[model samples]
Target: MGRHDDETETSYITVPSFFKCPISLDVMTSPVSLCTGVTYDRASIQRWLDGGNNTCPATMQLLKTQDLVPNLTLQRLIKLWSDSSGPGSSPILNPPSGTKVPTKEEVNESLNRLMTTLSRDDDVRIEILTRIVRFLKDSDTNREFLKKKKTEFITLLVGIIRMKTTTKKKMELVLMATKILDTIKPDRETLSNLMLNDDGGDCLTAMLLAIRRGDQDSKIEAVRVLDWISYDARSKLLVAEHDGVLTETIKLINVTDSDPSLIEASLSFLITISKSKRVGSKLIAAKVISKIKDILMTTEMTSVSVTEKSLKLLETLSSKREGRAEMCGEDNGRCVEGVVNKLLKVSTAATEHAVTILWCLCYVFREGTAAVERSNGVTKLLVVIQSNCSVMVRQMAKDLIKVLKINSSALSAYETKTTHIMPF
Candidate 1:
């Protein structure tokens, strides 16, 4: 029962990418069970196969002797092994057992079938490709499989990007391709070459173009990809290498007829880029700062959500003392005063988002309150806080009141003495 499969028999497990150990590809081998009771690795499985008896990876079911013929289809298995062993050879031991071993040509034929189906709008094709991609991810033989198909895979992805199709199908393919790219970390040099080709920027640039022209959801997905890339330190630098793309993206946010959600996505991308100090400064230098200021000051931006995002961008910009000073000073007034005035105006907005905007303004004011007061901003803040009816607005007033401290006795003693005076 304990006889290891690889003891004398050539184990069918493909050699791992970085190792030479004969591993199981049918089910996991040498699996370790975690504290959470999830098992991994194939050989560690406790069940013994009677000739072909293999345990289920999940349920540990004692599979029938006939079931051990790698769960892959005969055509797929043959192609996999044939490709591994080279011309006119079997890669794995397949002694009948009712499991047909696929020939290399058959595997190629199957892939051609998949591609044909992909061109059609059949759900079966979509499911098949998804399953194939997932199986490739799970199998031990995938490295070799991918090596042979890398060029075809890249072309397929570019085709998916270019296909004129329903948004749902387009997004599904995009997401699936994204997952594949993440899993494979494909050859960067090759990908870069494609990006430079007239047709190369197909997927990446397609995402950007979709965001610029497509509906809100499309734009959101596009930004999500941008955010993912920006999160990578190397990708952040690559984004900056694009000539004037960042500036153009920021300008899109200012479009009066642009999708509000798209604007939010654009701001989110900018925020991600801003996290990198070098890129943040470059964004500011690109004159995106002036555009952002114009949006923040627009009375026409009545969408509370839009205004909140504007405030968020402003908050990020003002996070640095230098950025704050540059912003406030650029408008021909002291930084703190101008900021305080904007906060006061927006604090009265009827939407909940206004509260967030006020909070950020107050945060900046707290940091630069001294600079603001020196520029005569205290009276402005006090005027809003003292008279504003919204409780939150009133609270902001009280908080800033402490910072301004214009006649402390009048504020503190007036409340106490007025508490006892009766109109009757």
Candidate 2:
């Protein structure tokens, strides 16, 4: 006879049975993981069963105590049963012994139980969602499942994003959602309504703020989303309609340190608007040139990598005709001079940053030949070429020296010709 109900409770927490074994599917006998934390150990179950009670130690399910058998026989049966099954079978379960049986109803029941657990609690939801997303990566049919649940998935992700809680949890959810969204390949038609139905100016503003709030990973993800929206053709056209987007991007670069990815993204966004003179004018009017100058001139003697990238970006900025005009013009010329002085100083002092600085100098001189001549930039550059240790920097410096000399000769010939042809 079964033990007293209270006895069963204690035994349930302690023993294992045939039902708990592979025979009846209670607690696993000697649970061993085939993959991840999922297990199929019959020994643990058999040990519990060996304790004289036939109850699943894990779930408290009753089992056939009479079916006690050695581990070798169970292993043999497991191999024989699995071998008889068809090409496809559950990775966790061994094949059936007597016949190939379908468990559609049982599988669905287990999934229903899991779904209930997932929906009833936030922690359970996050855990379940994490596992399912990982499983989806392995399953070919997950695409179909995702297509069917696209709206639901997006809604769930939006809910998580909106949830007010710890930053870590929020970031975890963000990463999960981004991975799933990428896998599912959700259409813009979905996010467009939530992210773009507004003028999108507000959405852009909010994303920028979120980017600054979290740590590196969160900010990187945030930047990805912003870059997606910022560079989208439709959004790009729409953003171009208002000057605020360009102004905000320029401001972001100015305030944020030299993040190469962000700088590159901002530069790309700037490139998109450069197609239109009005957009370019708006970018210029927003003081992009001055800010770029500031970035280029920063001589904090800290964060050399950032300074290197800033120098490269400065070269890019100063190369543009509009950029050069702004650089050589009244209010901004001093900024350019400051940038040149820093590049020269770093060239002599910092071997590594020196090469980059010299490379950028070459780019600036090459692109802004007229501006360099007007600003008398050649003499300073020549001094660096004569003394710098970095070979590339010296080479670039020498190149600029050659260009300045050639221009000087051309200017002299023109002047001499003009003098000889006086009164013509």
Candidate 3:
């Protein structure tokens, strides 16, 4: 009771007696029950057990065991009560009823009505599309149903996006369609059809516009669709041919407040586009090099997928003279430092790409060789060779080390470090 007295004296807001933990006398976020039939917040009880006490705080009854059973029903009721009540001591309202899941037939009917309404009137089209989007968000089964009819949905979506409607409702319809298409992931043939539209591929144009003007969620969906489309070589070329696709994609990378998923989609699209040398050069021209380097140096890039995609794109870009020059030319040496730091720090895929970037720099550009040697890149490469890297990576590391040894005298200082020596 000593702790209860201190807690009660400190709390200004009056908590319901049942809602307070018996041990801490505070409202519980996670309530659990002891074997003695007394409830306490999980953390408070855990602390009590850790302190070697085996008695219930409320009843002082001996507890047979320390195991805590979660009170899920109570937790939900507490959350509901907290949400409804307020400082003025208002009465708590009952939680709303859960929406029932729509059946597959109902989902199909909604889609049919949506397609039919598109031909009827603008108001009907917008309302139906909104309902469809809500249904799509309801469950994965609804999304899979839409995927089964991907051809029909893709055609309709492409047509709606191609129409030059600028009304707010029309724009909302376009955004919803984009989100649904992204969820369905139409096959390569369907995507090819979108690119081959008679209106000279207006679908890609519409997506670019969405990336530029839509809200964050819409923009994310647009980029995800674009990423899926870019899986095909022809589709990749079509996307790169668009004027703003590359620029807007890099802009998304630099967006400070974007969700991690959005940046991931943007990075994925860039990784696909970077497969083409022509498009890779365009990315370089758009100042993508510095932006990618910035991502590597900052703490924001914590997702391993993001780091891997960025590294893969860097590998592709580094194969070009322009990319190598830009990376080696950074005033603060972050580009080289970032690649070197990832030598064995990230996943195997990332490490391979990082080594490929270093290889390109060391062999393709004369200035690159000197810059890398100066950045302690040779030491990192040697570490990779000695570590438990894949055969391909170890070979690449050895090849880079040979290039360094042949090109510069700086490697001689670390000659004794090569325990797993490679034959020339």
Q: Pick the candidate with the highest lDDT.
A: 3
Q: Which candidate tops TM-score?
A: 3
RMSD to native, candidate 2: 15.3
Per-residue lDDT tens digits for candidate 3, residues 259-310, read: 6778788998888888888888899989998887876777654578877888
Model 2: per-residue Cα lDDT over 4-33, one tens digit each: 345433111222233233322434434342
Cα error, candidate 3, residue 296 (Å): 1.3
- For lDDT, candidate 1 versus 2, the one ahead is 1
Cα lDDT of all candidates, in order?
A: 0.50, 0.49, 0.71
In terms of lDDT, model 1 sits at 0.50
Clashing residue pairs, candidate 3?
none
**Best of the two (2, 3) by lDDT:** 3
In candidate 1, which residue ranges exceed 4 Å CA deviation?
Answer: 1-203, 211-217, 232-235, 334-380, 383-405, 410-424
Cα error of candidate 1 at position 404, Å: 5.6
Error of 1 at 324 (Å): 2.8
